[model samples]
Target: MAGRVKFGVVGLDEMLHGGLLRASICAIVGTYGTGKTMFALQFAYEGLNRGEKVIYISLEEREELLRATMAQKGWDAKVFDDRFSLLRLDPTDFNLAINSIKSELPALIRSTGATRVVIDPISLFEGLFTDESIQRQEMFGFIEMMRDEDCTLVLTSETDVRDQNGSKYGLVEYLADTVILLRYIRSPGLTEVHLALEVVKMRRSPHSREIKPFEIQEDGIMVYSEASLF
Candidate 1:
């Protein structure tokens, strides 16, 4: 955490008390269409623009498809290609993909000199192991690899359907330095997205205690200064 990485335009920097620190692992949990991918991808794009080497490890989508999605979100694939590295690894096949991730993560970091990384939809690997304990172990192992490489990691997880609460999968919340929850609140006939930033457990820094409202547009995710009543 020598040089803090600011998520500038998103207005999340203020919430984080200046942004996420280097060598820290953070989780972003949201349900489908809550803009989780957009948030994580935008962070990756931000890293590229900041002259920091980034590696986007995609799980649910292929590399090409991911690039296209970013393009539609107003990100230039060419610009991203020029500065950052992208590695797509889908764990739909479970053991094989997870093994590759465990084995190749360090090597990828070394090769790309990546200081920042985005593991989109990390919850995809939840079913890889039968036992809950084993699942936790695997996730911890992956996170450990990121820590060893001194990389700023952003992981995306799906909120449990049964329990609107954040914890359902493994000990992902326990292992992460920051836990961000994105949810859709339906009021009347309107549906809106809200972003909640919980320092959860910042190692040495202070963070916001409020769950702020964040809007996603062509420019990307932006947190509101204060809550507004409808």
Candidate 2:
């Protein structure tokens, strides 16, 4: 159960003392253009490279856009599509999409034999339900379904830090096993956005409290040990 899952990001790995542990829900929260989706893509790519089956679930972008983003960064997205599988959740109706995701996820996990699964910006499913309690309960059910399948799940949440605690859409933080926050910190003249991948909580693993910085390159997101260039 412990070693069945692992995160590939370097700074994050250093932060968690060895990255995300198995069968856990890791949330990467950030605002727009903070490289949240890319990080999710990187996780799935890393898993596929490791000879592990991966499933990429997209809610924000269409399948073409996602593939193009990876292609722009010089990654052969088609290679992974051939090796693993990608499921695009572009529903004509938001409610329909959420319901489809809930209904199809378990079967997808079983059919693909996916060891690593990523749901890009899980917040997209938020609008499907208005009541906070109902939303939390539904999210908890979705998370439990994924966990019961023994897949390492990476769920991304869109956050606006100007608000309180960097969590706007209810108690998403409380539900995840580990929460990694990425923020754009503004300075006097220069605006420096740093990636603070925090292990808010890890069930039985020794987690790091230090907020580390990271950078996005042609390859993908990299966790930097040293101070990044501002």
Candidate 3:
């Protein structure tokens, strides 16, 4: 059996029958306040706890904000300073950011011997291409390049309220080996709002299809696999 990359979120790994397959690209699609960034952070932190190197490429937040967020969970960012690399790119400059990623990301991964990678909000990168065909081709090539590096990767994307099953660009889910969807659900009578997570698809792996409830606590994100959303 192939090794798995622990999701680092409580109860999430068990839902996948262990964790995400090693050397696979997973797409996490969610809307605002779905805790996408926190989930990515937990994955990286879990890798760090296992003594594995992790690289976080952020298209949205800065390094200081990331460190601060981790600190709130009692995780000292400095503990894994030597093994953690955080790259904050300017999403405004599409050409420059893409060029930097193409030219420098592989070298950074190689030099750091990183085993886990998180590209938060890959929607920004997708927005760079105006044409859908070109975007799909380039995104697939980028994913292949990352997979060739032999690392577990998680790419996050924004989804609309209507298109919950697909990502912002609509091509990321198709390219990823696994697709995890997060969304906000309203209870009967529209009285309560709950955060739900579902494993829409996972290649070569058996995963629970149930839409589970999750929370962003003081520590980190926690998924309730056994609990019913109702």
Q: Which candidate is the best by TM-score?
A: 3
Best-to-worst ranking by TM-score: 3, 1, 2
Per-model CA lDDT versus the true structure: 0.75, 0.75, 0.90
Clashing pairs in 2: none
Runs in model 2 deviating more than 4 A are 160-164, 188-196, 226-230
Q: Superpose all Cα atoms of candidate 1 onto the true structure and report the RMSD in Å to 1 decimal.
A: 2.4
Better of 1 and 3 by lDDT: 3
Q: Residue 123 CA error for candidate 1 (Å)?
A: 1.0
Clashing residue pairs found in predicted model 3: none
Q: Estimate each model's TM-score.
A: 0.89, 0.89, 0.97
Tens-digit lDDT string for candidate 1 (1-230)? 58687765456788788888878888887777777788788888888877888888888888888888888878786865756777777676776778767887789788878888888777876666778888878777777777888788888888777865575584677788888777666555667434444445565678877666667777677787466423
- Model 2 C-alpha RMSD vs. true structure (Å) is 2.4
* Candidate no. 1 TM-score: 0.89
Per residue, candidate 2 scores C-alpha lDDT tens digits across 1-230 of 75745576666677677778887888888877778898898888788778888888787788888888878877786776655677777644776688778888788888878888888878877657788889888888887777788788888888854662465685667788888777655555765545445456776778766555677887777777555434
Report lDDT (Cα) of residue 132, candidate 3: 88
